[model samples]
Target: MGKAASALDYRELARRRLPHFLFEYVDGGSYGEVTLRRNIADLEAVALRQRVLNNVSEIDLSTELFGQRIRLPVGLGPIGLAGLTARRGEVQAARAAEAAGVPFCLSTVSACPLAEVAAGVTKPFWFQLYMIRDRVFMRDLMQTARGLDCSALIFTVDMPVPGSRYRDQRSGLAGAPGVLGDMRRVWQALKRPSWAWDVGIHGRPHQLGNAVPVLGNDSGLNDYFAWMSSNFDPTVTWKDLDFIRSEWNGPLIIKGILDPEDAHDAARLGADGIIVSNHGGRQLDGVQSTAVALGPIAEAVGDQLTVMADGGVRSGLDVVRLLALGAKTVLLGRAWAYALGSDGQRGVAHLLQLIEAEMRVAMALTGTTRIADLDRSKLVSAEAGANNRAAALA
Candidate 1:
């Protein structure tokens, strides 16, 4: 692809490189994608307060999360089947994240197994867990994560059942099963010869790595999806946190928290942190955008638990916006995924450089050199904007 200066540029490159099904899987959201659109729109609307006279010489973006001193307040959040983005994609992304001095969270539905990821990177990454019905399997998975020296456990709790994503159906990722479905995806793959040669041909045994033990070694994507559909425990409640805590002694982060009440509940349940997300607008169609939901949720549990957020974060400017709104750290989803698909480990490294550079400009212009100095003070107040509008109208 051409020069990729921003996450959006990488997204375009990814679209050109990947097939229809793969690109749509990474890009599209659930139902009509109302919440998905809202995520980007609301984040873009966040106004930063720019100031001049403060002598901003050096800027530092370093921060600590779950006891790890990361170079930036950004982490590569878990994305399933990320291995499909490139050859051993999750491993590539993890290596890039390590080089960037950021945490990488591996999904339960990942294409690369936990052991493989551990083998690929010297530093331990975080792992995301879904509420599965099988307790035996759950405990085993937790044990496996611990054995791999994972630094933290992120338990995602928003998806009781999978949301209705129309794009997946249209792209033959879901609804169409068996040989017909396989053929449909293969046809799309054939069109993207670059991806086919790289991920399809070279990247052999494209199966969900973690699920292999349960779903059997011969299972395909459809089988994995089908198994996940039946296995996800809809009856999951706060009591499930007890089970998680019992199995894990590391920093426990509850992902998919969007409501203040739920954030309070997570704090009460003794979660180390909470990721204020709506599952990237993949689970619900009309929920509040994370940008709109983050402030109140952070207010509710910021002291009791670390407040992190993810959704519609495409640029370092967007990262600054969320931090100003109250997020201590921001996890990137599609930004790194697109970069991975566009090139691979090198692409993700470039993306992090772009983010860090953009953040420097933002921090310097906002008269803040430290991440700790970023707060609501660096943001344009809604009340002030409204009053300015009113005075102009009068």
Candidate 2:
């Protein structure tokens, strides 16, 4: 791939490089995709105020999260099947994140195992967990994370059951059963010869690495998906968090919070942070966007816990918009995944550089010299600014 000027450029490259099934898996959302569209639209509708004649020399983009100093107020969010995007893709992304002085979060269903990724990178990365039905496996996973020296444990609370993503079903990507659908999937993979060679041919051990012990030997991709479909604990509730808290002694963050009540619950549970997200619009189709939900949640619990957000964040200016609304930092899900799918590690590095450069220009234009300086004052829309102020007052 040639040089990518923006995240969309890398997304286009990813579209060309990956097969239809794989691309749809990363790009599509659940049901009518109402929440998916709203996530981007609401973020774009947020206007930024412009200020002139302000000195912006020596801008410091570094910030502290969970007591670790990072290069930027952004981190690569957890992504499943990332290794299928390239050869050992999670390790490559983690290395790139470390090189860029940022954090890379590993998924519970990662194609690459945590031990391998931990061995490949210099710094400790974060781990995202999906509560499963088996307490033995869940506890073992936490022990494995602690053994790997994971910095934080992000407990995902939204997906009690997988959402209905019709695009995946239509594309034969979500294990649609039928000989014709199977043939179509095979044909699609055959068309992407380069991807097949790199990920299919050369990329051995296509099994879900972290789930190997429970799944036993000779488990394939289909078996992994089958396990996931049957294993997610639907009986989970707020009280179950005590089990996780007892097992993990590190900084804990509750992901998938989009309501003030949920945010307050996280804070009351002694969580160190709360991530305002809608699973990147992959869960609950008609729900509100993270951009719309973030302000109120932050206002309700910002004083008690750290607030972060992720959903339809495509650029550095979007990062600024999120911070102006109340997030201390933001996470990128599809942004870095697209880069990795397009050009592997180099693509992720370039994307990070592009976002950082964009953020610097945005901060200078908005008359802010530090990440801490961003607030409702920098918002161009009076209503948007007022919403945040009301959140604070409430």
Candidate 3:
């Protein structure tokens, strides 16, 4: 609505614009949200080694990923029900990403189906897949992605069982079952007249698009939730990855790798890349933040696999920090979602613009000219710096 200078500003706008439940769903994390807070805190604590008098007239933020050269080393990661943020929200976000020359990944539980999104954008977007219980459905989904000419297949492996998000329960998105819950959500929607008019009424048929075949044409959010509850197979193991690798011919990236062991396993299993993420702190409550987990994982498998990281990446500064921590590229989750919720395509485009601008300034100040040159050397360890200062004072 207003000029959003930062991702947090966009988040505030989204909080004001969208219904309470929808905003909470996009913003809140699982359990006590301990990991969620750490994701941001750890990133913010990273101190950059700023250098002066270095020729930074030519700063390049461009990088190549899976054979595609992007303007920035950042991508719009998959967020389920993203379309609810705006009318044909996924389509808008995809268009924005294409314009920005970055990847926009579509979630399997997206509000719009693959065909719909494909029809909207000229370039093929990435697709994120969740391991559903039905083999037939999973195989067909892979085939569908192939048919749509998807650039990459992101196999999200961390969500064998959905995490317990208390925010969803409090916001009437979960916990309250049946008509009572539905009515509560409806009442919240009615209060946000702008959102109600834009996304609620005009954005007709608020159902999970990709899941329609299995969920039936009449299925809505509640049915989608029930389907997820019953369908997410908790018994899934790394061996199941063989099935996915067999089906997907494109660049296959394993998302949600927080451990070096898992990164090694992904590389051994023939993955093209691995995203060092914790599902935006949505899956586990007390695990290490992506910023904290990325360095070791990158050292473990950076040569064997393309190392990407995501979680608490709110600005271009954070992007630079992750790159210095060993992320070849970084993914933006809540950042883009908040912008999308605030003003749809324009908000996303503006946010990307802001990120690029911030990255340039950060790189220039740090005396880094190229994205490839950004590594641990460009950062001053906050802990070590503090200890050094304490010793000097003592």
Candidate 3 residue-wise lDDT, 1-394, digit = tens: 6989998899999999999999999999999999999999999988899999999999998999998899999999999999998988999999999999999999999999999999999998999999999999999999998999999999999999999999999999987888999899999999989989999999877889999989888888788778888999899999998899889989999999999998999999899999999999899999999999999999999999899999999999999999999999999999999999999999999999999999999999999999999999999986789998899999
Candidate 1 per-residue lDDT, tens place, 1-394, comes to 6769899999999999999999999999999999999999999999999899998998999998877799999999999888899999999999999999999999999999999999999999999999999999889999999999999999999998988889999999888999999999999999999999999999978998998889888878899779878999999999999999999999999999989999999999899999999999899899999999999888878889899999999999999999999999999999999999999999999999999999999999999999999999999898998898899999
Better-scoring candidate (TM-score), 1 or 2: 1
TM-scores across all candidates? 0.99, 0.95, 0.98
The residue-level lDDT of candidate 1 at 70 comes to: 94
The C-alpha RMSD of each candidate to the native structure, in angstroms, is 0.8, 3.9, 1.0
lDDT values for all models: 0.94, 0.91, 0.94
Cα error, residue 286 of model 1, in Å, equals 0.3
| Residue-by-residue lDDT tens digits, candidate 2, 1-394 | 6789999899899999998988998998999899999999999988899999999987899999999999999999998888888888999999999999998999999888889999999889999999999999999999999999999999999999999888887777766655666677778889998898998788768778899999976766567668878999899999999999999999999999999988988999899999999998898999999889998888899899999999999999999999999999899999999999999999999999999999999999998999999987888766767897899999
Model 3 C-alpha RMSD to native? 1.0
> What is the TM-score of candidate 3?
0.98
In model 2, the runs with Cα more than 4 Å from the true position are 177-183, 382-394
